[model samples]
Target chain A: MTLSKRIIPCLDVTDGRVVKGINFIDLQDAGDPVEIAKNYNEQGADEITFLDITASSDNRDLILDIIESVAKQIFIPLTVGGGVRSVNDVRRLLNAGADKVSINTSAILNPELVKESSARFGSQCIVVAIDAKRVDDHWEVFTHGGRNKTGLDALEWAKKMVDYGAGELLLTSMDRDGTKSGFDLELTQQISDAVEVPIIASGGVGNLKHLVDGVKLGKADAVLAASIFHFGEFSIKDAKEFMKNNNVEVRL
Target chain B: MIAIVDYGMGNLKSVHNAFKFIAPAIDSVVTSDPKVINNADRVVFPGQGAMPDCIREIEERNLKDAIIHAAQSKPFLGICIGLQLLFEKSDEGNIEGLKILKGNVCRFVSSKTEKIKIPHMGWNSVAHHGNHPLWANISNHEKFYFVHSYYVKEANSEIVQGQTEYGQKFTSAVAKDNLFACQFHPEKSGSAGLQLLKNFTSWTC
Candidate 1:
């Protein structure tokens, strides 16, 4: 009767293509967003998240087209993040078939967006993404894709976002972004404890044990990984199997 | 023909697309027109958002009578907020419901020690009651994607077909006559969900 700890495979897309160097040489078109998403779906990944790293508005239509095709084929839940700045962006993505819309910069620039959008579209569909990095004794919230610091405490910002009607929190550690070390367990645990809503630990997941530790130690409801899965280091099945063996319930 | 009643609540694309993926040849349309809902062989009332908002939109569009008629006559399927609306009333906004079933929708409560989160999101297993047609080919305790805060408390226990536990046991799915509803989204629940949707397409009850 317990809820399974989710294992989400995030696809970093730039110019309508997967940005990571995938080692799936067997895949004819490894960088294809739809193909990669479909591959993860078949691998039993709990959910598929698309982080649109494309900054140019000219390529917006490409992502939408990709989302439409993937949503048509994939039966599981789809989450879209990155460059989502307004309610209209959320609408466009959801209409294109995203189950949840994650907001990072917009939410920080205008905190009301989280409240207003969640009011119109249920809170269940509004995910507030917090990019934070440790600053001495406490963690500080960072924005602009973890490039700038906001001087705001990460824990305080998380609780405030929940109050502003964020259903879930996607907590990413800037320090661990491409380090391949593991998740910032202390940060994840603090956010999980600070708020009642579910929090997903992201940024540093080098191996299968990291996934288990993300849930077991960090108390995170889900774990989001990119390069490790993208580089063919390990499959989602291997991660879930390891988690299940370690007594962490997961959807096999 | 299947008419998915879309009353400007949430995205009906995934639900519509799931039907298209299952039986490509079938005529499935997302329509707000009550006439289309009435004429269709089957009706799917799928929605998400606040209960009060859902109620306002359904009434403003003059879909109240149409939805009630469809539920009474044909194989009507209610999903998420749709399922919550079928009950007598809801704790959310203290609003009235469709009253199609003898039940009430109540929010999940948490204590100091056990802080069960609201909007019970993510995958959880369902314990089916018996050999229901919807449960056909699906194993017992199969996991389905769910995301909601409030849950139904059906007065008639016999009508409760499926149950799931979060902080406590709640009715996840219910079936009575031609009416079938669930707290989880079968359209977004992957294979097991697709199987449930396929079952609904051929469901004669």
Candidate 2:
């Protein structure tokens, strides 16, 4: 009855389209977010996360449209985030077809939002995403998309988020993000061990081996990757098979 | 008609969408009306949020009798909070459950025997008690999407149909006569999820 490790594909959606603003591919055109999510689901992604990285005022409608379209086409669970500030925002996204909503900057600003939303929608549907960077032998929490340091230690913040009623933690290493070097194993394990909640190791997934290491070494309950799956470096099926072979206990 | 009891929690659309996707002509409905829910030949109860809130909605909507009646008479399915409500009481909010079955809902504890996380959120394997139609075609290793802090602990073990493990082995699914319930979210559990819902459509008491 062991729970299988999960592999999640993260999409940085902006202005109603998948943001390929990274150097991986020149997706100058508005890549259909729903279509990309569908492809990931078919490729055996355990779950798909749509991070609303857009700062547009009309971004809510676009994100809702994406959730509706993908929820109908794909059968897996969908998590949406970005610009979610209040409990109403969580309801809006959940009603729009999201199984869970990840709150980062907004949660840091008003910690009560996590408690309110969790009490209203259940902690299972609330995820607290933390963007952390190693600083002077310790990790510092970042906000506003990893720009402003909040002076809150990542380990302490992780515990606080859990105490505040967060169901899961999506920990992203700012330095490893986009570099594809690999996730910060020591940091991930530190947080995973610190809090009993599930840890989703995001950023720094450079290769197939990184996915396996996420569970084996970092002890993350789930591994979230972006450029690798988005750019077709390797499919979710490939990663799951690799984990299954490495005795990481993944659903194949 | 299939009535997905809308006691004002969880996602009814996901269940409706899954049924509609599987059998486009399936006459499935999400209704809070006690008469409609009780009259349906097949009923599915899917719920999320807090147990006390869910129970409040059920009582406020006059659905307590309807849900209990349907569970006894019709082919019923309960999910997540819907499943927990079948027990006697929950440690969450100190609320009394429907008490349709004999058991108690306890919070996941990290004890000396075994340390586990609360809200066991993720995919986990479910081992069925015996051959059951609800699990038809779903393999033993097939993982289902789950997100809950509490679970059925000291259930009438005789009725516990399926069990899963996080830090310790616990019941995940239960069935007796016409009632079938699980802690995992089939609507969010990918292919195996759709398959289970499809099986429910064809299952008979």
Candidate 3:
């Protein structure tokens, strides 16, 4: 019963600008991370997740600054992931006021890292993120920013992580990453059904109906998207209203 | 003035923001200080995260007695986890609650439906059960944003002001003399949510 339907907004931070794309292409600057997070906070976003999508060293510093600035202004729970590799990285983010630290590449490289961090900081603070791509009709776990294949089945890895004491699972489908078509329901359902912890479904969110579908059909405890929210195409308020109309319970 | 209890749990800023939007003149502060709670015109308890942690923080800050006193003396508004804590106890943990409202917090039984999910997160319609000032300007069938798996099952149904249907109709809002609560997050709720805050602010009860 720890699972709550979460309406989350994802911010892709690069060089201090919030950027988003389809399949990680056609990159465009959306807005300031601080400004966007503030708006989402005011509009009632359950949580805000920031993904450091940039590779530049300078952008990394900028992302940290963005986190610090946004943390000051926002009061809701804030989660930051991407390019996070060590406990130091996690500590830095937490020191910057991040409520939860999400790990993807590091967890895939050393699955034991999930257990180690969970043991150190408590399970509720550790969020293991998984990126998957369809290979030979089988969902394969990917890492290194979704650019490399791990040759591991997504569901198997998710179950393993839970056994390792990861508190929550953040599952993102590479194929659907930026298409805005909809969430990969089959992938999301597989992880959700396999794991006991809360699952956050990310990738391919187009509109409010897709958000509702993510929770209702995909069985996700929360839905995360970047483009739709950053571009002003859909708002957290309108999205929650649509979910209400459709019978998807959100905190109003 | 509204004293927002700071129990080191989920977002209290958004709750304060909602109050600011609705009643700009309403004073709000996040503090565990008893003197502040005693001085406020009203009280708002908004919760996020776990219930056990919230209860512990309230006790650690020595605000338990103050919260109970405030509930007994002035208007109180509890939202989400805040509402769940008002009950007799919660299955979330073995910790005892404020017992201001008579009920036990239980998990949503979604096994009854194939489509319904737990954590019942999102916006859903609230069906009014009784006339309360908190419902003023809030349509009977209007929607509110909810994000929890557990709800209060009042020992006394008379305290329930609204109910919502997910797998089945459960209490969405409850009211007793000088005390009110909603399982939904009125701050996160949009315009209608703001209206509820406004109504609560202006209510004489």
The candidate that wins on lDDT is 1
- Residue range A1-252, candidate 2, lDDT tens digits: 487889998888888888762333333433888667766777788898998878768656789988888888788889998899888889989987898899999888999999999888888888999999999999999976578999999999999999988989999999898888999999999999899889999989999899888888998999999888777678789988888889888877
lDDT of 1: 0.91
Residue lDDT tens for model 3, A83-135? 88777777677657676789988897887778877655545557899899989
Candidate ordering by TM-score (highest first): 1, 2, 3
lDDT, candidate 2, residue B7? Answer: 79
**DockQ order of candidates, top first:** 1, 2, 3
| Model 3 misplacement above 4 A | A1-10, A21-30, A33-50, A54-103, A106-128, A160-169, A178-185, A195-201, A204-252, B112-116
Model 3: residue A140 alpha-carbon error in angstroms:
2.9
- Report clash pairs, candidate 2: B119-B149
Cα displacement (Å) at residue A208, model 2: 1.9
Candidate 3 to truth, TM: 0.75
Which pairs clash in the backbone of model 1? none
lDDT of each: 0.91, 0.87, 0.78
C-alpha lDDT (0 to 100) for residue B24 of candidate 1: 92
Model 1 alpha-carbon miss at residue A25, Å: 4.0
Q: Candidate 1 at B18: error in angstroms?
A: 0.2
In each prediction, how many residue pairs overlap at the backbone (N, C-alpha, C within less than 3 A)?
Answer: 0, 1, 12
Considering just the first chain, candidate 3 attains a TM-score of: 0.90
